[model samples]
Structure formats: structure tokens, C-alpha cells
Target: MDKDASGPKVVVGVDGSESSYAALRWAVRYAGLVGGTVDAVSVWELPGRYGWSAPAVDMDVDEEEARRRMRQELTDVLGTDAAESVRTHVVHGNPADVLLRAAEGAEVLVVGSRGRGGFARVLLGSVGQHVAQHAGCPVVIVRSGPS
Candidate 1:
């Protein structure tokens, strides 16, 4: 749906990875062309299994810090003018789930082929694949290669 009089809103997932950075850049350019705002989302999740140690307190604080850094990084890459057109969001949960939820009201969802995952795939990352398959809106899987 359109968030403004200009055009439909676009959502892009960011995890501070090189591929995600590329996707952010592409999303900014696309938004500029289509006259829409970009919602940059950064999702953080606690490690499922930690060593035989006590659960850490104040974890939410860490997540918030990470989110703030991510938003600043996106702003830095997109620059002040283009970044002003972007709305940053930081959520704590599964990356794929957060992105899919964000995609619910977006005209298009953009994500990189890979993030910090250590999967051995030669192509798309697991999170990107999941979003592409389940996102309600059109999904753009930005790769690290030439456009």
C-alpha cells in the first residue's frame, strides 16, 4: 500500500552484511525511481543454544544497540538526503519472520542473498529464500554481483 501521495512503500531487510548493504543501495535507488519511501528493518535474535553458562541479562539493551548501529550504517550508506526518505526499524526476533511481517503491507520486499549465516549454499541464503517464498509482496533478492 502507498504510505504517501508519491507511491507505494518498500521494505528492505538489513543485517549489516555486504550483500544486505548492496540490497539497501538498490532499494534506495529503486525508491528514488518509483517515488516511495523505504523501511529499513534490522532483526536480532538471541542465540538458540549458548554454552553451559548463565543466561545473559540486559540482552534487550544489546539488541537495541545493534539496531541503532544498523540504522546509522544504513543512513551513512544512503547519505542524508536519500536516508531522510527512509524509516528505520529494529525488531528482536527471527530475521525471516520479521521481514515477512514487514512485507505484509509493502508493495515490494528487498533482501540480500546472504547475511551472517554460515550456510554452505552457493546461491541464495536461507533467510532470503524463506522470505522470497513466503512474503506477501514481490521479493527482490539482491546478489553481491553486478546488476
Candidate 2:
């Protein structure tokens, strides 16, 4: 949360996907329009449905690696100059849960229609669906592909 300021706080989720980059860009513009600050959150979690009696341990998804990817995603999309306005957050948890937590006191929560996985769709990614249904504030689910 951007609790130190008086303006609106806009929270967005980025997952190092093209759709996520779109969400980040859209959030920046939306924040500019509403005099809000953007909190770009990227979440990592233990792999679900692991076979062979695997535990909730994922060696491939490191927290530091996720943070670096998120940072680089912002830099790639927003560039160094414009990306400064966005405050990045990297968390370890369910993406939906993390975004919902971030949206606790936010004015708006923006996310892409789909993340790195999932079939093609519009209006609701799994994470976006969860957040939109349970968030405390307004939710904006931005579609990435052509309209």
C-alpha cells in the first residue's frame, strides 16, 4: 500500500508476461488520470498439483528470481525514466491472494486477463477473477490481445 500519501493508491499485478506488461502500462496511465500511485505487485508460489507425492516446495521459483524478473519487466515496458513512478513488490503466495491483500485499501486494482499460463480468454484470468470477486475496491481486468 502507498499509505504515506493522500492520493489514490492503484495496485496492479505483474507476472513477467506480455499481458502483465499491458496491465502495468494501463495502470500507470490510469494512476496518472486519477492522481494515484501504482503498486506493481508480482507474486510467486509453490507449484500446484505436483505429482509423485511432492511437497509444496518449488526449486525453480525462487523469490529473488521472481523479483528480478518483475523488475526487468517493468524496466522493459516502462523504461527507466517512466518506470520510477511505479513501486514494485515481489511476494511469495498465491497471486490472487497477494493482489487481494494489496487491494485492501486501494482505490483500484488492475490486472491482465491472463498470466503466463492459461488458455486464451477475456475479462477474467483465474487470478483476476479471484481478485475481482473478493477485492475491497474497484477492479479493472485489462485484456491483452486485440479487441
Candidate 3:
């Protein structure tokens, strides 16, 4: 059992992907091992352009949807009891930027090898690569196991 409610913080980025689910599970187990709390973060932003031009976007709607999805993903991946133990955050910004900022002073930042986007041929996704290079704390990039 975790003795310290105020122990080290483990920050994890979840994007509802298989690799991300794997990362989430890993973060929970690691947090348990170290008696730390988990901070599960998800980020969403309107696309820069909609093919030719920018489309009208509703910030309120987008943020709310992001928050809802994050919560559902947490429950789907970690279940109710386990998910409740981790603090959840839904931010509006670039994935890498948000995750790095969230990881500030954290024990470690955990992310999947790839998120929703990117070519499978590539080893690491853009956000994972960026955070691995720029995060102030240690970063762990987990790849999903065989399905």
C-alpha cells in the first residue's frame, strides 16, 4: 500500500490508443511501487487548418469533449477504483507542450511510443519524441504489447 499520499508524482499522457493504455497501466504500477500519485493528462486542440482554410471552432465544446473523453478513457483503461486514484487533467494545447508542462518537477513523465497520429513504420510519435527530448524530468516511452 502507498504510505505517502504526498509522494512523488507520476505524469502520464493518454490518447485512447493501445500504446497509451499500456503506458497508463505502466504508470499505475510504477506509482504503486514508489508510493506516488498519478497525474493522467490529455490534450486537445483545433487543427491549424481545415485543408484550405480555418474552420469555425468552439473552444468550450472542444474542451468539454476532451475532458469527457479523457475521463472515459481513464475508466476504460484503468477501471473505476484504479482510475479514481489518479488525478486527471484535460488541457488545450499542443500535446507535447502540455505534457511537458504537466511533468514539471514530476518524478517521471510517461507516454506511449506513439499516439493517435503518425506512421506505424516510425518508432516514436512526434509528441513522444518531443517530450523525451525536452521534458525536465525522466521520460518513459512505452510500446504496446502484441494484441
**The best candidate in terms of lDDT:** 3
Model 2 per-residue lDDT tens digits across residues 15-37: 87777878888999999999989
lDDT for each candidate structure: 0.80, 0.82, 0.86
What would the per-residue lDDT of candidate 1 be over residues 48-80, giving only the tens digit for each residue?
A: 523426574454457667766876797788877
Q: Which of 1 and 3 is the better model by TM-score?
A: 3
Candidate 2 error regions (>4 Å):
48-54, 58-62, 121-123
lDDT score, candidate 3, position 64:
72
How do the predictions measure up, each by TM-score? 0.82, 0.85, 0.86
After the best TM-score superposition of candidate 2, give how far the Cα of residue 71 lies from its true spot, in angstroms.
1.8
13-97 per-residue lDDT for model 3 (tens digits): 9988899999999999999999999988887777652342676565555677777778878888889999889888887778888
| Regions of candidate 3 where Cα sits further than 4 Å from its true position | 1-5, 49-62
Backbone clash total, candidate 2:
0
